[model samples]
Target: MIRTSLPLKKSLKPKRCRSCGANFNPISSMSKACSVPCAMALNDAAKAKSAARAAKDERKSLAERKAKLKTRREWIAEAQAAVNKVARLRDLLAGHGCISCGARPQQKFGGTFDAGHYRSVGSAPHMRYYLPAIRGQCVRCNRDLGGSAVNFRKGLVERIGINRVEEIESMQWTAKWSVEYLERLKKVMNKKARRLEKRIEAKSEVNQLEAVE
Candidate 1:
């Protein structure tokens, strides 16, 4: 006996072009477009849109770069001014002996000195960066005193005796009180004092505000 296989049945269906509304018999049922040109045109449109978006992003990046450069230049100028101000103050305090040790310039023995302030910058803005408040100190003395007014004073008393320190503090000066000298001294001291006072007041105000918040 001979046996034969039955033929597969076909489903009723028609293929259509998505872009041109044309109909054709596609090898597969899932195919949408009738010709390759329709697919290429769709791809080209998508590529053009992507290129436009990239160009827009590049322009935004360049604008951001320019803004950053402008900000950097402004900061550099402010830094230079601060450095110059410090230099001027340093020169003005050179003639004074070590603020801590009272060691005369001649007694320094070629040792370098630092201009120290009685008040630190964080706690006392008035004295922190002022020239008159600065004092020359030998490296060893500065280290021994631990760079604090209280510590330095204690060390000074130990080194020179309390009587001598009292005498040094009591020395009187008689000078022709000139307007120019008074103005110069006030210029140096007053601004710093005012700023320090303002900062303290502001800090207190902020604390109150924070408490309310």
Candidate 2:
């Protein structure tokens, strides 16, 4: 049988020698080097260059993967920080003294305050971020006196009401936090923190002005 198809045209452009800069016409379009030695050299050099690029790319990809993993852990930590910040702000804004002690910051001996948890995060992880479960307390009362159990109950009842306090005590479910949920919670808590900071600042200025008068 005879093939009757027209012949294919070759590339007209002169190709540069892969091993040297000399220009030459390729015997066929697929030909890379002008001579045998140049072809072997070119092949080796091409292989080495390709290997180097692959290694560099692998290193870059590895670093990026590690960074992505780190983000989830960082978001979780940020969420916790934001929650604590908001809780502390809430206590301060309410003009309440320490939940474990009746002493105000100025009136207290050490004058340090912390957002103390009523149920404790270890026992009630579900209520870890519950606003009503936390209240302001002097450092001594919170840490030294073991959350000052006696006064803590009294303060919790007064601040959040008896019913709400009872509800928190009755809570028994575990709260599951995902990376995505924590990221969203961080944003919300951060916004609340900013607003609370502004309010606190404004109130401080007003108090200063009044004292001066």
Candidate 3:
């Protein structure tokens, strides 16, 4: 049931202009702009949005093309570099010095340390990204003397315990790393590295505050 309770309006209510928020009596139901200037503004805004979307698509296409040009080995190396970066930062945060020569990493990642592996990637590619199998080592021991294997063993046993070190030593799987797997690994490690950086920055701020106090 319907009841006529109050007085009626003289005409339909004014519509809000899409471009300018001003209210107007639209010329037609389909009209969105209140005036020619507002119409022009709306058109320009739509065109700019379309252009920006097109630019984003073009950039994404270019990145895909560049990624496609890289070889499987290149992908592997890139993923490995990301893993090493995260591993080095991990050891640095833990206050563990070089696993080989017992030299300390400079308080930062500053090219003085390398993420050395207990089993070289050439020998055990399966453990390439394994955290327990890798440690931060001074550049001198990792690059100059080739991991300093004998010393690294003693250090590895102490850090991860003998059972874990032996488990790594006795592992016997043939790892076939795919480009897809490496790509995923790279993205994950990069994310972790960023988080680690934030943690380090927060710790530094705390230390500074303590010193001031």
Candidate 4:
């Protein structure tokens, strides 16, 4: 049970000064430089090399981030979302439920709805952000049947005048959106949507109180 431990093995190679190339027996296994001055010089050089490498990596990372930055497309998408939200709420409040099906929100099985476009975005990319072109519709009519184009056209004409519908249909100009414009539009649309939501909530409260009375 009582056993004596053997001494730890030491490296056979003598320590060499990394800074001056002088060889000597090392005090410890980790001792690389022979003299204090050699060790200090080696440390300073290593620190400088590490700093240079770190600076290079930081520059590379910043350049890559700039290269992969979001463009006008992302801004447009966000602005469109806010616009659609406001349009859907507007239609709901106006009692123009499901422009394609004439199905009221209360009549629908689910509460889900969408701001459907009269002119499909794929067909008219220029009118994607056009507020008048978008109207509220049931999920079934919009997503499942691809907007029911026939009914949508009729409803659109009735909702907005025939002249306006013709104008939008004849529009050939493509508008190039800027990020600044899109950002501003997004804020405006969001504020309008929030105000509409408050009105809808207040109206509901009034109707509920009347029903109870």
Candidate 5:
């Protein structure tokens, strides 16, 4: 490899500031601001404006977060209410035994049980929240049967034949009860009942006015 040397020029110079119209003169030619105070003042003013903008943005972000949290809380309450309503319906049906096998004293079963569906909520959207469609299943049996309509139905057909399966699918609910499916079932039930009562009262008032006229 060959070594090379480049010649130095003596005519290099610094440029003037466009804002203050001041020329920069220093040992280093590339200096922009005339003095330390000038540079500091410009930087300080920029920093202050940036801090103000950041504070404003922070307040806006906090407000948006609070609103989002409030909406989430409201949705959670509504979901809890729906779950409680379903539980109340379940309790009423619990005394009758397992809708599938006619098992007695269901709570005496050694294993845990889930509220199983005869006709799946996905298929019967209208009766999705209905209590009679729900049934208690022993964990062992539920797990063994795969916790699905197809699986449960197959098991039922094998155990008691198609005739019994058809009979179970048509049984009606004759009682109402509540269970621990969600938080504060009593409070949710009271609130819903109150709302329903108010609606009934409003309808009755309208009917009374029409009758009077």
Candidate 6:
């Protein structure tokens, strides 16, 4: 038995060198560089790219670890801040007066305005994220005066009606906030705040419009 000659394999299409940008015929399908120097440069480039990618992954992993190390109290605080910011922003946009003291929003006297809870957070941790129970308040009324409960009740009644206020007061509930739940709440509140922020007009723009009028 005799062996016949095999048909010649077709050459692959020319490829551009990754390093020098010149086109060259490759020895095999997987070949990249045209010359030894280009091959070395390409190899160095690949190693550098891999190192950079590894560094990026390490940084991301380190950040995730640091986040995991944060205490539950810190997570709760952050979520609370997000909710508080939205409450204040809601009243600010609506131009509502202070819930505790009838202090006007434009008034210069008073500490910085805050999201005042009608049912104090200390008393009702369950209602911490309750929007209806919270309203705009000055620092003097909210912090310095310890929420001025009687005045807050009256203001809340006037704003939300006696029925709603009473309903909020009558409610008694407990919550077990997990880290995942708190994280989601923070993200949701932040998203709401961002949406509300878009509705706010810049002071300069408002002034210009008023001046034009």
Candidate 1 C-alpha lDDT tens digits along 1-213: 899989886753777667677887675766766778976766687799899999999999996676455543344334333432443334333343555665654433554655454344445533333443344555656566567576556654654578865664454443343344434454555555455556656766887999999
Each model's lDDT = 0.55, 0.82, 0.88, 0.86, 0.56, 0.87
lDDT of candidate 4 vs native? 0.86
Give every collision pair in model 3.
none
Question: What's the C-alpha lDDT at position 177 in model 6?
Answer: 94
Query: Using TM-score as the measure, what is the rank order of every candidate, best first?
Result: 3, 6, 4, 2, 5, 1
Best of the two (1, 6) by lDDT: 6
Q: What is the TM-score of each candidate against the true structure?
A: 0.27, 0.62, 0.75, 0.63, 0.30, 0.67
Error of 2 at 199 (Å): 0.4
**Candidate 5 error regions (>4 Å):** 1-94, 104-111, 148-213
| Residue 55 lDDT in candidate 6 | 100
RMSD of 4: 17.6
Error of 4 at 122 (Å): 1.4
Name model 4 segments beyond 4 Å from true: 1-69, 106-111
In terms of TM-score, which candidate is stronger, 2 or 3?
Answer: 3
**Poorest 10 consecutive residues of model 2 by lDDT?**
102-111
Candidate 5, overall lDDT? 0.56
Off by over 4 Å in 1: 1-95, 104-111, 151-213
Please tell me which predicted candidate would have the highest lDDT against the true structure. Answer: 3
Residue by residue across 97-200, what tens digits does model 5's lDDT show?
44445444334444355556566544543344454445555555445565556655765565457887787676554422223322344357557656655665
Which has the greatest TM-score?
3
Q: Report the error of model 4 at residue 153, Å.
A: 0.9
Measured by TM-score, how close is model 5 to the native structure? 0.30
Better of 4 and 5 by lDDT: 4
Which segments of candidate 3 are over 4 A away from where they belong? 1-53, 107-110
